[model samples]
Target: MVMGYVSGAVVFLVGLLGGVGLGIACRQYWVEKRNRQTREQAASVIAEARKEAETIKKEAILQAKDTLFQMKAEFERESKESRKEFQNLEKRLLQKEENLDKKSEALDKRETTIGKREKLILQQEKEIGDKEKELDAIMDEQRRRLENLSGISSQEAKEMLIRMVENEARHEAALMVKKIETEARETSDKKAKNIIALAIQRYAGDYVAEKTVSVVNLPNEEMKGRIIGREGRNIRAIEASTGIDLIIDDTPEAVILSGYNPIRREVARVSLERLISDGRIHPARIEEIVEKVNLEVENSIREAGEQAAFDVGVHGIHPEIIKLLGKLKYRTSYAQNVLQHSREVAFLCGIMAAELGLNEKHAKRAGLLHDIGKAIDHEMEGPHAIIGADLAKRYGESHVIVHSIAAHHEDVPAEDILAILVQAADALSGARPGARKELLETYVRRLEDLERIASSFSGINKAYAIQAGRELRIIVESDMVSDSEVVLLSRDIAKKIESELSYPGQIKVTVIRETRAVEYAR
Candidate 1:
């Protein structure tokens, strides 16, 4: 059993070994087959990969060639467009060159045309110069021939003719001058009289007789004692306060206020009257009254001046000048109120200026201020006109106004129409009847002056001053005075009166030529 077991075991072992061998072989074979299959698969994959790479390479090459062809085509198209642009630019440049050549030719033609015009103008100028020279030569020749024919030179002949014509003109002018003078005198005299009459008629003014002293009428005799006070203290206080003298004299219930300054005198007068009325005349009361009166009088003076200016239609007077004008309210000239006189003069000046077509306001201003110097003439050394002019100059009055003031009184020569107008207005105001008070001697002398002036003429035989020296009636011999001579004689006498005599208003000279031929028929 052991041996058989051994043989079976051996066979089994051998068979197991063979099986193991076969299994090993089979495993090797399967492994080799799987390896071969894997290698084949790897080779196939490699071959396929190669085929795909070749295909891709071919496509890539095709694509690259197509891209190159497209690039070339695009380059060619761009080059074509660039070449076409260059061609167009070259054509434009050629056309610009052709246009430049045309403009250059046009410029050359315009230059030639301008050159021709300049030459023509220069030739014309030369021809005109030559003609002027030829004409001058001909004129010189003609002048010499004419001079030779006339025996005198042309210049001498012209002078001789001028003298002959002048002589004839002189004779005619002398006759014309006489006629013109006659007409002018007749017309001017009538016009002047008319203006003066108009001024007088238009102005309605009341004449106030000026007094040398301001008199304050008292209520009763007992009031005078109250003004004198104890030991004259009140009177002294009043005077000291007002700068005016209080003249308490035997004037019968009247106190005289006296001072060179009209303003001060006015203050003293009003103060005394108030003191007498109040029945309080102590030194303190007197000073208080005088102080009050001073302001009141000053205001009155200012108002009077302003009112006077307003009435005359004058404006823009200096405040100081207006104050001085107000002081004229208390002043007197030739027994006439200076303020009234100034107003009259202003009105007259305005009227005359309006008639003559002059500046009425300017004339009135000059007339109003003409006598302003008289306000302070009592304190001044020179003429009122000079004093007034100095005041106006100091106060910045216009040159014309200052000159007019200075010349109004003939203190200076009346240079302008304003000065002359002022003078005329002043005379008209003072010379009018009842305008100013005149002494008997002055009146008589004025009458004599009129007669003397009228008789001073050549043709007049007898001269008489009628109408209070306003009219001079002259009797001339019929043989000596023709109708024309009579008119001339009257004008001469009137002119002499104006130039020589200083009368207020104009004097009328009337010349009468009477012829009486009486035959005794008995």
Candidate 2:
């Protein structure tokens, strides 16, 4: 029984193993079949997708070709149009080139014609020159024959004719000069009179004539002795301090202060009077008084300068210049106060400038500064006018003002209207009657000298000094002096007077030549 049971179990185990093998084989077969089917479906889908892709690729290729063809055709059309336009432009350019060539040819022809005309003109000019030479020769020959017939050379005849013409021209020129002078004098006199009168009427300044010396009266004669001090110490101190000389003469309680500088003299006079009144007569006292008086006088001078500028309505003067102007207050020109004279000149300048339609303020400024040099003339060299001009220039005055200052006294030529105005104003101020004074002896001597100079000239029979020695009238012998000789004689006398004498303003020299015809009746 054990054997049979083992056999049956083995068979059963065999069957079970066979069954399990069969099931695994069947499952493997099914899986293979399914895998084949899946592969076939995938293949088909891949083939269809490939065909669709090919179709899309073809369509894209066709569209690209069509676009390329259309673009090429459009480009061809545009190129054809452009080529046609270019051909038209080329034709137009060729026509313009032909026109330019024709114009060039016409210009060449015109240039040739102009060259021929120039040659003809040159030939005509040469012919004209030849004819002119021939004509000149013939005319010269005729002139020579006429000269020989007249018994005079051509040059001599020409000289005679020139002399005649010159004489006639000279006479006419003299008449014209006289006429012009008359008219000018009449107009100038009226204008000048009006202006001067207006100036004088507007200004009423008092004339103060300063003397060279100033007097200081003392309280008693004993004061002189004290002022003299021991060995003249006090007087020396006073003189040294004031730059003046104290004249302690026996003049009865008075001392004379002498100085070339009026300011110094004034200072000395004031200082001495103060010392006398205070009863202090020492060198220290003298110096102290001098310093005090100097300061006072300086203040006075500054006030005067300010007043002068105020009166003239001029401003913007430099302080240093104003100080120098103030010094003019103490200055005197021929006994005429220089400051007063400057004021008069300024007024006159203003009036004249107004009438002439010039800058009145500028004119007045120039006039006021014209004589500024007189303030320090003794300390410097050169004419006052030139010195004043230099001062003005150094102090930054305008060129016009500097020139006017220099020319006012004729030190330099009056080149500007302002200069001329200043000159005229200066003359009006200085040349008025009694405006200035000279010593009687000098005045008489000047008149005598003027007469003597006039008489010294040749052909002058008599000489007379008239118009306060401003004019010299000389009588010439009729036989000795012709009209021209009389003129020359007058000029000679004037030149001699100018060289030998010094006079103010100007001198007029007149020479008279008169012929008398007398027959005795029996």
Candidate of highest TM-score:
1
Provide the clash count, candidate 1: 0
What global local distance difference test value does model 2 have?
A: 0.85
lDDT of 1 by residue, 220-304 (tens): 8888787777888877788789876777788898887765566776777777777777886788887777778778887988999
Query: For each candidate, C-alpha RMSD in Å?
Result: 26.1, 23.0
- Residue 53, model 1: lDDT of 100
User: Model 1, poorest ten-residue lDDT window?
Assistant: 201-210
Cα lDDT tens digits, model 2, 391-417, are: 999998999999999998677888989
Per-prediction TM-score, please?
0.48, 0.47
Task: State which candidate has the highest lDDT.
Answer: 2
